[model samples]
Target: MGHPKFPSKHYDTPSHPWQKVRIEQEAGLIHQYGLKNKREIWKANTKVREMRRQARKLTANSSDEQFQKEKNLLLAKLNRLGMLDENAGLEDVLRMTPESFLERRLQTQVYLQGLSSTVRQARQLIVHGHISIDGAVARVPGILVTRPQEKSISYSPASALNSDLHPVRPGIQETFEDEVEGKTQDNEKVKGESEDNAKTDAKTDSKKDKETETDKEEEKK
Candidate 1:
């Protein structure tokens, strides 16, 4: 991919009014991919442009084997990302863009993997060193996980140890349910105690009133 010539500032609009629709598209990509900035999208665009450039170059000769080789490489990469299926064809590779490449990233895939609650959380978990892939610690949120490796993704035992039921722990949600039930029981107990206290106070007041009335009668006599 060519080195991006653009500045690092976040772009709200493309400067040209004709590119106004791009702002919406860019924002959607950022939200959907959980990107940190618009620069990332631009970076992906350049990267895809480079890939397309390579494809165009390789196919300039128009040899069958060259085309197949390029297709295979793209397929392998995409399959590693868990995007393309087992029966994907060369036509699919032609349709592959940088967005397709980005979608396969570890952060996005992990979110789609249903490990973390959201895309950003998946990225955070990865960057925070809370996640692992293929039984090896993978701290890079941008790591593109293969389908087989995706199965291997798991939480660090330490990270899993102490927390309210986060998405990382399936067992923790059940524990949370138990905790809620316990709280409900505790609340019922408190209510019962409060009712008992009210009854006792009422009885005491009644007794005191009767005693006062008797004292008044005695005084009168």
Candidate 2:
């Protein structure tokens, strides 16, 4: 309906944009998921809102046979998107959160599958066309990964990320190991320093005691 060059806004801005609690929650999600900005969170929230709205409409028309079919279809779609379980009902859809939608994104899935060290890196790889879905390059990090697509997600055959020697290939495991080793070495160094300081203090106290004993003996003489 509108100009194709400028797409309609997919998300609604909050009524109270400066609300403290909402801002804190959004900040946590942004950091936890390594999101580019709050717009990603808003997009997920919009998706959840739409799903719940559809569920409400279906429930209100429970008497219609067509409604039942549509409800089943909706459930299947949500289930495929990993937002609902196998036995999930309309209530599950109604209870869905923005986080559930965000978790289904290609970036999150790629990170979860151990293809990248962090969500940010996953997004980068995807946006750079290093990732693929069903053997086709998928550049959109925000793509909703369905159940079938989940299995098909992998580094693009032509991408350097597919190589074992690639920097990001080892992902979290190598970095985690290096972090643990570094921490252990740091602890050992701190312990060694503490022991050395204790020994120095004990020697200083012993020397002072000896000096005091010698001075008392001379005074008595």
Candidate 3:
């Protein structure tokens, strides 16, 4: 076993570091999911790669008894992570992408559940111990959340965010309709404010130009 202080790397770096397309894709994922770094993306990629490899193996040995056992195990694991349906098979596993893994992360679940306004906020809330699952604080933002655990995700009991009155907490909605209505109202309010400001600025600029023209005309006289 390795030293407890220095654990083995859980992820692999890209084989070709200078691949522009891969780099851009990873950057987009990182921004979308609020990942700490490319290492997180690499970790998800490695996990998906391993699952796909197993899927391919099971596909090749589909007629074997041992293959059935192993295939069931893999499918069960993926289902628990909410990455597959009850009737999904090896084909679905082979189709899995790093995004499938990323979507099951605790931070992503938190954001999807509306516990935070953004994925970045979800990560921050988790890291700061404001987020919880089944009433227990979960400090790891990237931990793979299970289907059952996803339902239990919420504010930690001790966290200030548990209080609905907390300033930092995003607006909570009881239904999808309410969430959409809230967002729509906020957008309209922001748009109205922006238009008002633009009109005020235009008026100020016009008055300044008039003043400049009057000053020039007076000097000529």
The best candidate by lDDT is 3
Q: Report every candidate's CA lDDT.
A: 0.73, 0.91, 0.92
* Candidate with the larger TM-score of 1 and 3: 3
- Model 2, poorest ten-residue lDDT window? 164-173
lDDT of 2 at 138: 99
Candidate 1 pairs with clashing backbones: none
Ranking according to TM-score, highest score first: 2, 3, 1
lDDT of 3 at 123: 92
Give each model's clash number.
0, 0, 0
Q: Tens-digit lDDT track for model 1 on 124-181?
A: 8888878777666778876766778868777765676236546355456567778999
Q: Evaluate model 1: give its TM-score.
A: 0.60
Writing each residue's lDDT as its tens digit, candidate 3 over 28-95 gives 99999999999999999899999999899999999999999999999999999999999998999988
- lDDT of residue 28 for candidate 3: 98
The 10-residue segment with the lowest total lDDT in model 1: 6-15
lDDT score, candidate 3: 0.92
Off by over 4 Å in 2: 171-221
Residue 35 lDDT, candidate 2, scale 0-100: 90
* lDDT tens per residue, model 2, 1-221: 79999999989888887999999999999988879999999989888899999999999999999999999999999998888999999999998999998888999999999888788988899999999999999998888999989999999989977667665675545977899999999999999999999999999999999999999999999
